[model samples]
Target chain A: SQELEQSPQSLIVQEGKNLTINCTSSKTLYGLYWYKQKYGEGLIFLMMLQKGGEEKSHEKITAKLDEKKQQSSLHITASQPSHAGIYLCGAGRGGGADGLTFGKGTHLIIQP
Target chain B: GAGVSQSPSNKVTEKGKDVELRCDPISGHTALYWYRQSLGQGLEFLIYFQGNSAPDKSGLPSDRFSAERTGGSVSTLTIQRTQQEDSAVYLCASSLWAQGEQYFGPGTRLTVT
Candidate 1:
């Protein structure tokens, strides 16, 4: 089974500051997904990275998959209160039909 | 268009009782998934359904857990003789294809007391 470990299990950052969350996998990553979840709510898809060295960005958030495909990072620029939540990283190996293994998630706290 | 919908947003059941959680995927989606998230824990894969193919039940935690997708649309996850450990949020997701991006539903919060 593949395992994903996220660094800085919990983080507190000032609004408008930049922060980065890291996800490391125990095995080669075939598909990496980033999602955000508000307290007690469902997860919202943020981005998906498949190829090694792939990077994708949406608005103030950017995600990058390392060339080794064993680690990924999510960086937030000029964070806001809305960014405060749980950020989770999920990985899938082989085919897409396979269920994803997820990290425990990083709890982000943005202080205004 | 609707993403995914789940019934009984919150359910409270007693130990030794059975519970059923329903999930309605997006229209025309061929892939549906069930995941459980316990407090302070990450999402755990429960099952996967793609088109008419047999569901992938590999992720099920135990034989007490089972699910069914009727007409390849709606899915129901049944937990028999629920225990306190069964308390968690059950989320449903759907994607246009097996490899496509998945959209999740609000999830059903089950609390077994």
Candidate 2:
């Protein structure tokens, strides 16, 4: 079974600061997905990275998959209060039908 | 298009009782999954249903947990003789394919006393 370990169980940053959250997998990643969740709400898909060395960005958030596909990072540039939430990384192996293995998630708080 | 939806946004049960959580996947989705999230913890994969194929139950925490998909659309997860530890949010997700991006429902918060 694949396991994902996320760094910095939680993060607090001042508004307009930059932050990064990392997700490391125990097995080779066939696909990596980033999602944001407001407390008590369903997760919202952020980005998905498949190919090794692939990077995808939406708005102020960017995600990159390592060449080895064993690790990925989510970077938020000029973060704002809206970016405050739990950032979760989900890793998948093989086909799309397989269930993903997820990390514990990083709780991000933006200070005004 | 409507995304995945779960019934009874919140549930409170007593230990030794049984509970059922329902999930309605998006129309035409070929894959559905169930996951549990303990307070302040990450998601734990519970089971998966893909089309009419046998579901993957390897992630089920114990035999007391069981699930069935009806007509390949709605899924129900039943926890028999629930324990206090069973308190958590049960989330349901669906995707066009198993490996594609999954859409998640708001989830049912189950609190066992």
- Residues B10-108 of candidate 2: C-alpha lDDT, one tens digit per residue: 999999999999999999999999999997657988899999999999889999999999999999999999999999999999999878899999999
Model 1 chain B worst lDDT run, 10 consecutive residues: B38-47
Among residues 3 or more apart in sequence or in different chains, the pairs in candidate 2 whose N, CA or C atoms overlap within 3 Å are A96-B98, A96-B99, A97-B98, A97-B99
Residue B109 local lDDT, model 2:
97
lDDT of 1 at A16: 98
Candidate 2 chain A weakest ten by summed lDDT: A91-100
Candidate 1 stretches greater than 4 Å from native: A93-97
User: B20, model 2: CA deviation in Å?
Assistant: 0.9
Candidate 2 global TM-score: 0.95
- Clashing residue pairs in candidate 1 are none
For candidate 1, write residues A2-109 as lDDT tens digits. Answer: 889999899999999999999999987888999999998898999999899899999999999994848999999999999999999998844444778889999999
